[model samples]
Every structure is written in structure tokens, then in C-alpha cells.
Target: MCYAKKLNFKLKTCTTLSRVNALSSVAVKFAAYLCTIDSPDIANDYLKVQSLQEIAALIGTTSRHLNRVLQKWTEQQIISRTDDMIHIKDWQAIQEISEDIRFV
Candidate 1:
């Protein structure tokens, strides 16, 4: 049997798991960084200037994958994305997801 055919999990579930784990691993560092800034809204400015490629490099991820994850988060209302900006819409939710490894 092929590798994917043997799994008990759906591919979508697996992808979400991967994204959450990746984001959680980085979230501690990111959340701390956010706190240092005077306002949460300012984070959008930082996100705005960086291309997805640049942001991915900074986060040690592929641009394509990061973009997909961001889009998913946007759809979920965890974040809002504009042409050049990304705004974190829910800090409490973000914190919960970031800190809870068991989240799903």
C-alpha cells in the first residue's frame, strides 16, 4: 500500500497538524517579540514590508507553505491580510493556539 493510504488521519488533518505545530514552535518567540512593541497593530507594519519569501526565510519555512498557512488563518479570522499587511485579529486565540500543543 502507498504511505498515504495507510494513515488513520485525513490529509487535511495532517496538514493542519503540521501547520499548528510549526506555528506553535515559533509562537513563543514571536509572542515575546510582539509584546516588546508598543502596539499590536504595529506588527502589521513589519509584516507589510516583507515579501512572503522574506518572511518565510525569517521564519525558516517555505514561502508557499507559509502563505497557505497564513491564508488558512485569515479565513479562520485569526488574522487579517491585506495586499501588504497582515494583522493579528485575535491575540487571545493566538495565544491559546501558540501555548497549547494539544490544540486541534
Candidate 2:
């Protein structure tokens, strides 16, 4: 019985860590996408027609999750949202976060 409890606890801990890692990866990818928006090598034409939901899907996250991440960024003044658009207020910060793997 004690062994079973330990195994269960280990499973839960692994699951939690996996979730954290997945979210971190998603954030990094999203930040990378934002950072490269103006890069000459990056094609952004798809963004012109994609809605937030479509973009979120392309990024491998749900729209609600993407919105939550954006909301947090707005609170931190890293970006601003008006209507259906998002403007990066701190390109350096976004790039740093993307490179440093910082979630906020």
C-alpha cells in the first residue's frame, strides 16, 4: 500500500512538471513568432486572414489559453490589446523572454 502511494505521488509530480514544460514551450514558441513578425525571412501573410482562433490553432494552443497568456502580458505592459489586435510595447522584452525561456 505504501509503495502504491509513492508511485501515485510520483505520477502526479511528473504530470505537473510535464504540464509546466508544455506551457513554457508554448510561450516560447509564441514569443518567437511575435519577435519574428517583421523579419524579412518570415512570412506573415497568413496572419492577415487568420483570426485569433486560427492563429492559436496554428500555434498548438487553444484560443482561451492564448488569450490568458496575452492578458498576462498586457498586465505586465509587454503588449497591449485593442479591439482584435495586439501591439508589442516592448520588443526587447519579448525577445528576451523568448530567448531566456521566461514565462512572464
Judging by TM-score against the true structure, name the best candidate. 2
Off by over 4 Å in 2: 1-24, 43-49, 100-104
Write the residue-wise lDDT of candidate 1 on 69-88 in tens digits.
Answer: 77777888988988977798
Taken over the whole model, the C-alpha lDDT of each candidate is: 0.52, 0.65
RMSD of each: 13.2, 12.4
Q: Report how far off residue 50 is in candidate 1 (Å).
A: 3.0
- Give TM-scores for every candidate, taking all chains together and pairing residue i with residue i: 0.48, 0.64
Clashes of each: 0, 0
Candidate 2 TM-score to native? 0.64
lDDT of 2 by residue, 31-85 (tens): 8656555556655443322478865754568988888889989999999999988
lDDT, candidate 1, at 100: 36
